[model samples]
Target chain A: MMRNKALAAPFVLWAMIFIVVPLVMIVWYGVTIEEPIPYTEIVQPDGSVIYQLEDGSRTTEKPWQKRAVFSLNNFRRMLEPTYLRLLLRSLKVAVITTAICLLLGYPVALILTGRDFKRPALWLLLLILPMWMNFLLRTYSWMSILENSGILNSWIARLREAIPALDEWLLSMGVRRRIIFLYNENAVILGMVYNYLSFMIMPIYTVIEKIDKSLLEAAADLGASPVKSFLRVTLPYSLPGVLEGITMVFVPAVTTFVISQLMGGGKVPLIGDIIQNQFGKSSDWHFGATLSLLVMVVVLAFMGALGRIDKDDEPHKEVRIL
Target chain B: MNWKKNLRKAYIGLIMAFLYAPIVMLILYSFNNSKSRAQWGGFTLRWYHELFTDEAIMGALGTTLSIGFLAAAISTVLGTFGAIALFQMKRRPRQAMLSVVNLPMLNSEVVTGVSLMLLFAMAHIQLGYVTLLLSHVAFCVPYVVLSVMPKLRQLDPNLAEAAQDLGATPMQGFLRVILPDIMPGVFSGFVMALTMSIDDFVVSFFTTGSGVSNLSITIYTMAKRGISPKINALSTLIFACVFILLIGVNLQDLRRDPRKGKVEKVRIPY
Candidate 1:
């Protein structure tokens, strides 16, 4: 009993410092103001330049001020349509990305567990290894594939030299116009789907591996077709994975501005983009905190509702929760 | 049935191809000797050489490695104790604590990043290595706990009971009896924490204050400016490292853990 108590003290201490305090602080800061924008310099492409910006909002004499008061303006400003639109964009892309990830991941997982592949080890490695590399690095990789001067364009140009029909088709169809799709929500969806697909797979595979083979055999015996048996038996059993996959993909997808900005361009700001603007570009840490806190609340609410609904049919209902 | 079976086979092949295609493109582009980033000039080792010599990239690599090591170490100690505490508890408190530990893991990386940024900045604290290390440890604890908890669950509780009956202190029972059994679990937890710490950028990005860069940050800045084969070189290196680690883990599973092992390692690895 004494040893157990000693062991538990460390866990509680670490949790309070690292997890609980940080999360609570995010809320507390949401209601307070921080620095205003620092100085700015605008340099023209030619050699001329102009410069301007306010001092840190909390400070007065071009230096750090004493005793800055807390302000609520940051929270109040989030109601603007422009900001809300960004939030909606976050929702739209997150939903689409998560939906696509489920579609792509589920079919692949089904095939993996349903039948033995020639090199099962290799397939599993392929699924997992991309996840272990740098997240930003992988996101950057897609840039080469999607950009105008990148692989597809080069390939088309090569094909143009060899095949007149293909060259003419490429010229006529103008497939190069895909460069225009850059900085759009589709890019966000694609990036999110690619990044989080494995999360979907791991959980689904966990559940799928546990499913009794007899259940599938019984479904087949009932005279149901292959697809029907899958829909009724396999899909229902895998809902736990789907539940986890949604939260895993959706929250990041919605809040991620980097993938969208780098891949999609800064044209369509998601909630993440706006929050980033507040902190990095705008120097409105207070506003960013407000936006971030709002996102946390929404996530909490979204996850809470999902938990309530998903709990109804979870396998080992006690073990899995958000 | 024959046609349907053929279609299924084709579908599986297509999926595999899709999975393999992007990585292959990345590798092929890394060797594209041109600076245009678009046109593939020819195969060359030029960029890899460049990546090695670049001061900024190297600096970022150093930061990433240091943070990864620190965070992994912290996660292991806390996570090991947390897992054991849950195992020893009666029931309800254990369940609640386990759930709380898992909560951070379930949250999205972007959300976690943003929340940490707010938390750090609000406290009027500097956001640098400190925040990054703290948040990394926070998320990694769950992975360590999850990995260790399963192995703990599989052990026969009777062994510990027997150890106690033989005049062993609780500490002695755990150290001599439980530690040996859970060493593999601890190794797995360490592996997961290390990989996660290395892979993370979003959390690090938000927590890291201005100018203290890591590899992912440097790569991100470059990519933002424009696509560079330099980044391709970096990606290739990262991919190589991950590939080796994945192979190592899979090989270990094959040799060591029956449930995780596949048919490939009927042979030996010394």
Candidate 2:
């Protein structure tokens, strides 16, 4: 074992250089801001200002240079109301998505794990196959369904034409000819749930599928009803999986830019979108790093809390995306 | 009781419809003759033809596959050795190492992406294929290690020692005895790493330089401008490939043991 322990040295080194250093780099970028170097402005005799540099070199032009110096400017900016609102909006969306996924996904997992259910593998595969497709494509496909003039709207329009009285009744109730389903906060949540539903189902299914049947029988023998047995036995056993599912769905939901981008149509920008903007259009890596540090801390805090609750569960056996 | 069964069936059907509606819409619209997404002018295969001929899409596909392979290969080797080493270490050190390995997988992709981007910027390494591949490997190695670990745990620790007792050198013992047992895990890990690399968007989006993009990035940029039927066409093709690959892998496992391999990759991580 001692001799074989040397085998991991290369991987350890790789992890340190890649995994550890990049995080340290984030912190480095997070805590720092570019400040213009202080200079002594000397009024030149020729009606021009000369700048005295830090090293006492005189230049005819004003010194407008900035250096990356340690400052909490980015952190302070992060605390601004605009950024705080974005953070709150992102969390709100993520929480909604997680709740929706749990509500929708738990039953799917329960049904598939039922003893009466045949070929659960095939069913699970059917559930996960869509995820195997390109994630961007999957999100993009929703546009066709939910867009104002998209399929759903078109179908509703046709139905309204076919039933004129019903259409007039709907018009009286203030229903638009074409529903604006896409490009909003709810649309973004829909995208998240559609994409991440399997992530919720898979873990819950895995844990519930492994729950001992005898425990249910024992509960029944104790005069517990089916729902009572589920509450007393199955629910308690599935807590770890539920937590895992929530983490899986919530973290990605919170951190997602793509779903928000495509579904929200830039109308509903999450913290992820803002962070991406800082890197892309904004070109504020320092600010982006600050936002990223905030996201990382929030996500880590969440996972750490979940990890504590499910500490008795084997951490290694938590297979993500399976 | 009969109604209960019917209710379950109906529930499953409803969920399936919700899940498949978008996918079906994409597949249906791929063959659309009209350029507009709302109306179906007529059925045509023109989009698929354009999908193949489109230079940007083809180029991105090539880059994606090449990076997927290279990253998977590099990570599998690194992770295999890392897993073996971790298995041999004392509990405290092993736990520490495992948590470090989990960081990239557990961390938000945006954070991981930016952090790596910063690292590359600091190192003065130009972002392109190399940085993209490196980041993919970095994130992917953990999956490989996790996949292979259970296999290592299942292996009798003395098997390698027994091979040594039979006059085999440590490397030979490892190659013959330990490798065979862990091959399934290694293979699965390789496939896992490959799929992960291919499917990745966020990490590649940040790490890749201009004029170099994977399919996901290509699709993202194209999609942002508006919907293109060509993307729908490309989605159909990718979906077909994934479907076949997953079915083939699972079927192979089923053939090996009917009772086992019920799920695609229920690899029990140790």
| Each prediction's RMSD to truth | 7.9, 3.9
Query: lDDT value for candidate 2?
Result: 0.86
lDDT of 2 by residue, B61-130 (tens): 9999999999999999999888877776666677888888888878989998999999999999999999
DockQ for each candidate?
0.38, 0.52
True contacts kept of 1: 0.39
**Model 1, range A1-322, lDDT digits (tens) per residue?**
3556677777877777667776676666667765544555556688665555454233222443333347788777898887887787788888888888888778777776766564454565667666655666667667667767766656666777789887678768875533444567677677777778777776676677678889999999999898899899998998887787777777777778778877787776778877777767777666777887788777878889788222321122122100
Among the numbered candidates, top lDDT falls to 2
lDDT of 1 by residue, B33-120 (tens): 8877566698899988898898887888888889888988988877877888767765666766766776676566665777777667
Best by DockQ: 2
Candidate with best TM-score: 2
Predicted structure 1: lDDT: 0.72
